[model samples]
Target chain A: MVETFGRHIRQSLGQLSYAAGFQLFLFKETFNFLGKRRIGLRVLILQILFTGVEALSIISLLSLGIGAVIIIQGAQLPDFLLGEQLYRILIIVIARELGPLLTAFVIIARSGSAITTELGNMVVSHEMEAYLSVGIHPVSQLGVPRLIGMSISMFLLTVYSNVFGLLGSLTVSSIITRVRLADHLSALFANFYLVDIVASIAKSFVFGIIIAATSVYYGFSVSGAITEVPVKTIRSIGVSIVLCVIADGIIILLTMLVTA
Target chain B: MIDVPIVLDDVTIRFDGRAALDGLSLEFQRGKSTAVIGSSGSGKSLVLKCAAGLIFPEEGDVLFEGRSIATMGEREYQQMQARTGFHFQDAALWANKSLGENLSLPLLAADPDLSDYALHGKVAESFASVKLELDPSLRPAAISMGQQKMVSFLRATISRPEILFLDDSLSFMDHAGSRQLMARIEEFKDAGATIIIATHNREFSGRLADRVVVLSDGRMVASGPYQEVMSSQDPALLPVLRDLV
Candidate 1:
């Protein structure tokens, strides 16, 4: 048993060494990537296309649906509770948690899983080896664009979702009750802080990095034929969600503690 | 005449206390064809990996065109990669890409300067030479094994590499198919490309290699011209030679 455990540890160390080496290669690639002024601009453009424009519609729809649902549900509450505090629920749920989580889920479903499968295919086909052979680092060439795009996507989508959700809440509230657009905006802006906005941005960035990094890690670590792509992707999504949620919780707690 | 195309000097590769290659020394001359034959786990593939700079040796250096690849930087390594083509046993086609995309990858990676039309023309020409009609839109899964092999072969040559390595690339082919592929390889060799094929195919090795290297248990058992290696009096090579005949 001891021998077996030792063997496992040794093998794991070797594997870790391989992964660490690749990561260092990725870091070097990233440094080189940042040094290239034109590629950065191109990457920024691609990021906007990937993370901004691509996210607009879904964010709009999801936020609208959630806003409508919240208003409908809040309507069922006793009049006393719904009268003054209804907007607060919309602000807290949609802006603080639901918007970001939903945006992350969208990315996972649409882009995150796709990145894993794509990088996985690259790994299995030895394209990574080919890239290395040609003096191009795979992480820099592949990972940086993905990391940048994903992080940007998460941030943009969250902001978009929150904005649209707020609009949705106002629209729904106006139709169902006596709340005006002016009142809704007044309440929302009154409660909003630079710190809160920064928190949202920071959370989105962390979520993006986690999603991109975990997906790529799992994708590259996948050990099998082409058929295993979906399996790896599913695993990546599962891990990303768990990590994102934990990270979100920790960040929120940390922010609260610091503020208090 | 071109010095030595590649030089492996006293290279040793050990895995978990087991020697995959034990202090092996060899040379591949410029524009020549050599075949490495051995049974499973005899470290034939390891030699190719070492040559391609995929695996580092515990000892010794691999010199490509006189410069050691052991300490070669990213720029020099990339330059070396441009100068070599490699095909694996399973073809290793990028599954996510269409055949045309796969063929264009190395060229784009190596040169990044060629016009799209010129790249397309080069790709078409390579496919033409391989005698495989690669559909511009067909993914790797949509192709047959033979077609995949052909695509892989074309992809290897897209960069017009000076040296080519094939590790059991023809293992899955039928005899006639193998012959045709070997003939294509010979054509590449005749065009002044150094070719090294690591295989268990005795007959293919006999017909294709100018020099045949016999590796057994991580050591070179025999090395010489095909006729001589195949007719060696060494007891260890007797069975391998008999298998060839």
Candidate 2:
């Protein structure tokens, strides 16, 4: 029983080491592709369209719903208790926290799974060999564009989600609580500091890199079977979400420490 | 004596504790066609992959033009690859790209300065060689399996690499199509390109290979001229040689 347990632990460690090594190789190849200008602009644009532009409507609707719920809940509390501080709360929650997390959730659901499955299928089909045999590096041709596109898209989406969430909540407040839109806007602008913007962007950017890199890592790790594609896709999503949350916490903490 | 362009020296490959290839040493004569024949699980395809630098052997070296491919830098290895072509058994065409794009990628990678018209012209020439005149915009899914294999052959040879490797590339085609493609492969050999093929098809091997190497249980059983090896009654070769008969 001890031997079996030890074997299992060893296998897990080996798998982890393999994954870390693959990520480093991918990171080096991505930078090499960028430096050499081997980046395929057409592929980059397509990824952006798929990961960012195509996600706008869904993000808009979800952000609007979230914004309204937060405002409604905050208003239900005693005015003497919350008062003008409500906008500050909204800015912190929506802009600094929920915006990046929710945007990454959408991306992990959509683009992350797709990247894993697509690359996994390519491996099973021997299309990866097709790329390698021709002297075209798959990581350079496929991974780099996806990495750059998803990272940029995630950052932009975070900003978009925040704007819609803040605006949607203010619109709801205007109708339900008789709060003027101008007053809400003033409070938001006053409380929304530069650090908040930096923190949100940093979180989204790091989360984007994590998602793209992890998805590609798992995708390339697939071997032999078609059934492995879905398995890797699920793993990519789970791992990417967990990493994004941890990164969010770290970034927020660091930002607070620096500003304090 | 014919000059050798590629040599496998004391190569060994293992998978899951079993040696797929065990200290196998062989040289491929320049501008000559060689066939590696073996039963299933006998490491025929693995030998071809190692020679092509697609898979590295666990022990020993693969030398191309007298230099160890294992020691070559990435740029040098890529340049070496650019001058070589490999056709997979499954054809392995990129599903995401159209047939035209699949054919264009290697050509463009080899020479990025080629004009669009020039690329189209080269692609057209290759399709015409195979008597295939389909729309280039069609994806591999829209094509038949036989056509996909033919496209893969064309994709591999379009750049006219100095060395070509075909891993059972003609297995799926009709006899007539196979004959035509083999004839084209012959034309490639005549142009001074070294050709190596791994196949179970006796007639195909007999027709194309001047030298035949028979493999069994990951070891070299027989090696010589095609007729001599096929005619050998050695006990180690009987099982595989029976297929040729």
Candidate 3:
């Protein structure tokens, strides 16, 4: 039993190693092809449209709600400290941490699973073999676009969350607090540093890689059976969520270390 | 251009501890037609797939000319792929792409510089070759099995590949459709594309095969010039060759 567990762990590690290498190669090939092939660029555009643009509604709504709650709760602080605490809390919660994490969760629930299912179905239907026989490399053609698209989407969505999130708290603060408008605006700008934006970008990029690579790898892992499609899809979704969460924690810890 | 003949040296493939192809070796000559015939589990399709570099063998190597395909460079492999075409037993058309895109993909891969107008012209020309009038926009699921097979045939031949592998390609075709594909196959042969097919149709194989390989239980039982193999008196080859002989 122990041996079996060890073997499973070994297999999982090997799979992850192979997937990381494949994604790196895919990234190079996708960009190389992007310059020469219109077809690849078109696929990248469609991926961004489906993964980023279509997801804006839920992202905006969630950010708005979270930002408002933080403001209303911060208002309970002693009057003199309320103004400064509000901006610092908002920047920390909305910009540095929650914004990237929540956006990643949304992508894991949405685009990651969809990518896995779509590729898994393609594998089941022999479309991948068809691609190979026809001289098209599946990883270069299908994978790179999705990787670049998800990373691009993740970066954009995280920024969008920051914008909508701050706007949300600002609007709520204007209504509830008697702090002068000029002071509030200045405090908000002062509390927000360049490192926060950089942190968001770093967190989003790492999360995007984890999700896209995990999904595409599982999708192609569906071998020879229609039943395997759903199995792989579930595995893809589960692994993506776990990895994203772990990555979010690590990025937070690293950034904290760096700034300290 | 792809080099020929394709040689399989003592190839073996196993699935779930059972050998699908066991120590089978065959060589396909340039500009010639070879047919692989066998019973249900006899590995005829396995031979074609191995030859096409789709499946690697456990025991030995498949070589294009003298170079092992197992270790071939990417540029060279891509060249072989562009120069070769395979028709699957189940049609295996892309589910998401339209029939037009299915045909266009192979053509585009072969020559990415082809203009869109020229690409459509070529697609239309191939559709005309088969006399298939279905919309190019129809997905594989939207078409009948026979129509799917025809589109598959068109896609395989769209680029006029120098090496062609067809696996039970006529399974879903009717009399007229089969005739259309056979005529096209003849044109491919006439143009010097090496033709390798796995089929149960003795008449089709007998008519086109310059040589025949009979497989039984994942091993080659008989292989020779078409007429020589057909007339052999060996008892071991008799059962597999009964109908063909």
Error of 1 at A129 (Å): 3.5
**Which stretches of model 1 miss by more than 4 angstroms?**
A1-21, A34-89, A130-136, A181-183, A223-239, A242-260, B9-23, B57-61, B65-70, B172-180, B242-245
Cα lDDT computed for each candidate against the true fold: 0.78, 0.88, 0.85
Q: What is candidate 2's lDDT per residue for B2-24, written digit by digit as tens?
A: 38878999999998889999999
lDDT of 3 by residue, B1-245 (tens): 44556999999999888999999889898899999988778998889989988878989899987889889876787788888899988898988778999999888787788899999999999999878898999899998999998999889888888889999988988899888888889899999989998988887887888999999989998888888987889999877776542
lDDT of 1 by residue, A67-180 (tens): 888877777867722444665666667887788888888888777897888888877777776555544556666787777777877887888889988788778877776767
List the pairs of residues colliding in candidate 1: none
What is the TM-score of each predicted model, taking all chains together?
0.81, 0.95, 0.91
TM-score of chain B of each: 0.92, 0.96, 0.95
lDDT of 1 at A201: 82
Report the backbone clash tally of model 1.
Answer: 0
The RMSD (Cα, Å) of candidate 1 is: 4.3
In terms of docking quality, model 2 is medium
Task: Give lDDT tens digits, candidate 3, residues A130-166.
Answer: 8888877787778878888999999999999988888
Candidate whose DockQ is highest: 3
Cα deviation of B144, candidate 3, in Å: 1.8
Please report how far candidate 1 places residue B170 from its true position, in Å.
2.7
